[model samples]
Structure formats: C-alpha cells, structure tokens
Target: MPDTLRLVTFNIAHGRGLSLYQKFSSPERIRKNLRAIGELMVKVDADIVAMQEVDEDSHWNWNINLLKEIQAVAGYEYAELGVNNRRTGKRPLAYGNAILSRHRLEHWHTQSFGEATLGEKGFLYAEIDYKGQVVPLLNAHLDFRSRKRRVEQVESIMDYIIENAHRGPDERPLAPIICGDFNSRSKPQADAVNHLFQHILKHREYHLYPRDKRTFPAHLPSKTIDFVFLPEPYRMTRCEVLPGFLSDHKPVLLEFEL
Candidate 1:
C-alpha cells in the first residue's frame, strides 16, 4: 500500500449529463454520459470514489444500474450502493450514494432522512480495508432546500458516528473520512459544513479541503457545496476541484496521507 490515498466525491446528476431534467434523456444517452464519467475516473485513478445521486433500477434513468455502468468502465474491485430512496410499481425508483473502491468494503450501512421514497436525502457508511488497514468512511448528501433540515441531518450523522465509534467490527477504526455534496455553504457562520467541522473539532483537528473552490453549477460556480472532512492522523497532501461537465456539480478530489 502507498503512503497516500486518493479519493473523489462527485454528484453525477444521475448520469443525465448537464441537463436540468433527467426525464428528457434517453436510456442509451444516459449510459453514454455515465461511461464518459467512468473514463474521467480512470484518468483520476482514485483509490476510492464516493458518489451521490447515482441510480439503480430507477425509471427516470431507464432502470439502469448506474453503479455497474460506471464500474464497467472505471473498474473498481468492489462497489456498494446505499439506497436512500426506493419506490416500486409503474414508476419504479431506487437511487442514492455509492462507493467504489479498489479495496474491500465491509459493514456497509445506509440511512435516509425521511420515509418518502422520492427525493429523500441521506448517507452511506462503510469500513474499507486497504491491505491490513481499516478506514471508516461516510458518504453523505444532506437536504438541499432547507438550512434547518441540513443542520438536523448533520446532527444525525454525528450521532451515528458516536454510536458506532466503539462498537465497530474493526479492531482499530480510524476517524471517518466524510465526503460528499453537503448542500450547505461553508460560510455565514451556521452552515452545515462548518457545523459538522466544529463538532469533529471537539475530539481532534479536522480539515475541510478545497476551502474556496466553487463546485456547484459547474459552468459558473457561485459557491462550494462539495467537500471532504478529514480528521487527524490523515494529512491532506492536495485537494482541488476537477474540471468537467459530466454533472451540474464538478468533482472534488483529495489526496491525503494516512
């Protein structure tokens, strides 16, 4: 194993390209768009990829398993989908956050903010085994519309971390490397990103990367809603926003030393 780990967190807009609505895209077109994203992943050569808004058997995306499509080209050894929303029948739907890793993923868990099967946001937690090292990772997507809800969601995630910290299957579970589309800005004093970072600071120093790099609205980004919160023992070597039009939100990459 190398001294550093490279990871990328991206919201692929359900593999619908830059379109505002996924319903307008044909199944084949969506597949092609997703393959292009996979190509980007190959170029980035990240050890682990965390994704939000990925689909699996979703009607809007033509019932395509978006993770498999990406893995087909990206070629990760292990892939797991954490479905936060799932609806069946005429308008079937299933989509959420996912992780693709070159290492093994174990003890996977998923949670949703609400019981509603559509448009619900949540997170995925997993313990990844890289050689003999065990790393705890959380891939999250908070409420995009409400500040209060985003804060509440952050609280829930913190609680989850506290509850699992000691009882985890791993003998030595490192502090989580939390990454994803937080949906809340890092400014104005009360945003979810700052809120989560402050909570983590109680125990040890945590670093939030790509400090001022805007990621949303890829073409003309106004604010950054994507980030990686890495705790102590893992030092950030480099963090940057990658250029791409694969999704409405550009991907953020983090290279860190464990």
Candidate 2:
C-alpha cells in the first residue's frame, strides 16, 4: 500500500516587502516572485503545503488573496487559511499561515503561537483522513525578533499537541506531524527539534531545549533552523531545502511514511 505523505513548509514572506537588497518595488518583480514560488510548489508535489506570510489584505496587490492565488496555481482543492494579522484600521490585512492538502480533511483549527503581541504568529492544525485513518499536520511560523520568544512559542506548540491532540470536537487526532518556519538560529534551537531522537539515541532527556535556531541562508545553510519534526510513529523519508526564490527564507519539504 502507498501509505506515505509528502509535507512541505515555506515562509513565502507574503506581502512583508522586498529584501534590503531589493530597492525598486516593481509589479513585474513581485509577480515574478510569486510565480517563482508557485512553480517550486508544483514540482515539490507535497500532499500538504504549509505556507506562512501569505497576504489576505487589500493594501497591496502583493497581499491580495495570495493563499488562494497560489493554490489555484498549484491546483490543490483543499485548503485552510489561518488569519493572524486581524483587521486593525483601514488596513484590514490578514496574512498568516496556510495549509493545502490533497487528502480529505477530517478536522481543522487555526492556532496562535506567539507569547506576546510583538509579531503575531499562527499554526494550521489539520487532520488528514487518508485510507480511513486520521493524521494531524501542523504548519507554523514562529516569531523572529527574539530567541526567547521563539522558544516559548515552540514550547507552547508542543504542550498543545501532547495535551490536546486527541481532544478536538469534530475530528480525531491521530498524530502530530509538525513542520514550519521556526526562526531559531542557534545550537540550542537546532537540537530542540530532535528531542525524542536525542533521548533515544543520545541517551539524554533533552538537549538545547531552550535555544533559538535559525534556518535561513538556504543556499549555504550554515545553521539548521527550518524543520519537519516527525514523532515516534512517523518516519522521515527525505528532507531538503529549496532556497533563493520569492521568499526571504527557503522552502523545505519532508517526505515521510505514515
């Protein structure tokens, strides 16, 4: 039986604005960027795509219903958009995380992970009903200002899963397959993703449990920050970084078997 899943996570940087290296704000340039992102996702062929920084506001065309547009380009029917930047003033912007799936969804919830209101972050928790079983997939984007804040967000996420995974009202939580843009850029944060692996193989309960890890500089990824954390039951088949595209950060894909 083909009982495997391909999941992808990328902080598409939505309408945040151009990089410091980019000075001129050209529509063609932005469209090119979006097109670039869409093309990459099409090739990845992930069963589920979790994207951050997608625009849902109307201030700029770059922010115009980006999740939907991208989905249309990728040809995925099922999708979920969790709006983190709620409407505040004439600028009713709502760019958060998005989860796209080809499988039938059993349950869905939009979760916030920011400890404070610095730069709000969210996660798209979804249950994929494949072959008569439920598998939970989480797509998240953590804060980037401080390491402490990011670590707190990670802790909250882990706690939420372990405590409330199987307690959703309308859906059953099979297992959490977490993947996203975790802006932790240090040794402490990098090792935190492998908590159970470290415990089992390295014989330690935890290492680098409270540190920030960075996953930027995809072409020359010096520090591993982005991740697709597979728990005990889930097995990782492949992991790779797709860098230097539309988004400031690189896109990551994880192939695994359920």
Candidate 3:
C-alpha cells in the first residue's frame, strides 16, 4: 500500500558463515547464526527477501528448515521454496532458493537449468500483489563455477521472463524485478557479468543498481556479485549493502517505486 517497496537478496550459505567448506557445524552455532540473521531481517523490515543456498531438513544444518526459521523470525506471512539440488537416501539433503514475502505470492513457479558443471541451480518466479498491482518477481541463483554455464542460465531466465512477463511492444506493462546472487565477479574482465548485463539490456529496457558496493565475503567484502535489476516503469529510489557476516554474502537492499 505504500509508495515504495523494499526488497533484499541474501545468500545465507546455509548459516555456515566463513566455514563453508566444513560438512556441518554444532547445533548451537547454527542456531545462533540463524537467530542473528533473523534479527537482522526484522531490523531491515523488507517487504520481500530472496535467499540463496538455503537448506531444508538437511543434516548439514542439524536438519533444520532454515527457510521456516527465517520466515518465522522475519514475520513474513508468505513464502515459496525452490529446491534445485536434492539428495535422496536415509537422510535426504535439499538445497535451493527461497522467497519470503509480506505480500501475497501467487502463481509461483520454479525451473531448473538442467545439469550444469557444478550442480543444479534454478530460479523462483512469482507474482506479488503489491497495493493492487501485480508485480512479477524473480529470485535466481546461477551456476557459480563456469562462466559459460552462467551465461546460458541468464539466457534461460531472460527467455522465461519474455514468455511469461512480457506484455508486448505497445503495452507498457509493469516491468519485472529480478534479484539474486549472480555469482558474476566485479572485475572488468569478468565476461559473465558483462554478458549477462548486456543480454538484459538487449532484451528489455532494464536498469541495474550501480556497482558501488561489495557483497561477497561478508566480513570483509570485496566483490559485487549480487544484484537487483529493474526494468522500465519500476525505478529504484535507494540501494544499500547491509553490513553483516550472518552469511558469506551481505544482503543487498533496494527500495523501489512502481
């Protein structure tokens, strides 16, 4: 109902922080980390939060459903979980993306990029009812290992958007918002980031948040991999990188007007 919408994109790193290589951590540690992250979310009070590397009933985080905990702590009424990677056995492990929203999330959909070099990754698409406006929202996590794979993933996402969100050339439909950890480094020679940026520019009237801050390695961040892209009719009022090491990547918060 308000004039502006605040959204955040975070990679929780399964609540492991800097110790990402470890198989698992003590229950106490994980709980503490989750609590801290929840408190941060409450403080930020974002209308929607797109998360990456979230665990669902996984042993790595002591079988805790991180998404539920986050939703509860952040006081979000709606949520959608997209499991991109799952291991089936006695103790099944599932990992993927999640979107926690204060608004109603309708017609939610998920798609996987079908076997990349590193692992399976995908995006979560949904339409949020924001003050009577239907806003198409996308939360995505691309392949982290291969640049070529990431480019393909970006192309796939662009195609999905065109098929579902595009309203034609004449109609000025509400431009969709895409947010996530693109995993595209900030270096000038980072072809993946350039390719993805150019691809969006070519396909749609898109605008990206200025790369003025770093998000990864949260404690002493140095890379601007996470991003928020807004197309025409949806302009950002403000953008900030929240300071925290709750996850390996700091949350990027964007306030936009529709």
Clashes within 3 Å, all models in order: 0, 9, 0
Q: Write the per-residue lDDT of candidate 1 for residues 1-258, one digit (tens) a residue.
A: 548889999999999989888989998889899999889989988999999999998888888999999999989999999999999999999999999999998678999988889889999999888766778899999988888989999999999988786333555445798999999888756979989989988866788887879999998999899999998888888898999799999999999987
The parts of candidate 2 lying over 4 Å away from their true place are 15-18, 21-24, 58-62, 114-118, 167-173, 189-215, 218-220
List the lowest-lDDT window of 10 residues for candidate 2: 202-211
**TM-score: the better of candidates 2 and 3:** 3
Measured on C-alpha atoms, candidate 1 has an lDDT of 0.90
Candidate 3, residues 1-258, lDDT tens digits: the string is 538888899988887867764256787787778888878878977998899888887766777888888777778999989888787676577878899989998678888888432258899888898866787888899888888888888889878877777353467544578888888874545555667667777767877764688887888887888988877777788899998678788899998887
Instruction: Provide TM-scores for the models.
Output: 0.96, 0.79, 0.91
Which has the higher TM-score value, candidate number 1 or candidate number 2?
1
Q: Please give, for residues 151-243, the per-residue lDDT of candidate 2 as tens digits.
A: 666677766766667543555444577777776543462433443233323321222211233346644456655676666466666776665
**Candidate of highest TM-score:** 1
Ranking by TM-score: 1, 3, 2
lDDT of each: 0.90, 0.65, 0.80
lDDT value for model 2: 0.65
**Candidate no. 1 TM-score:** 0.96
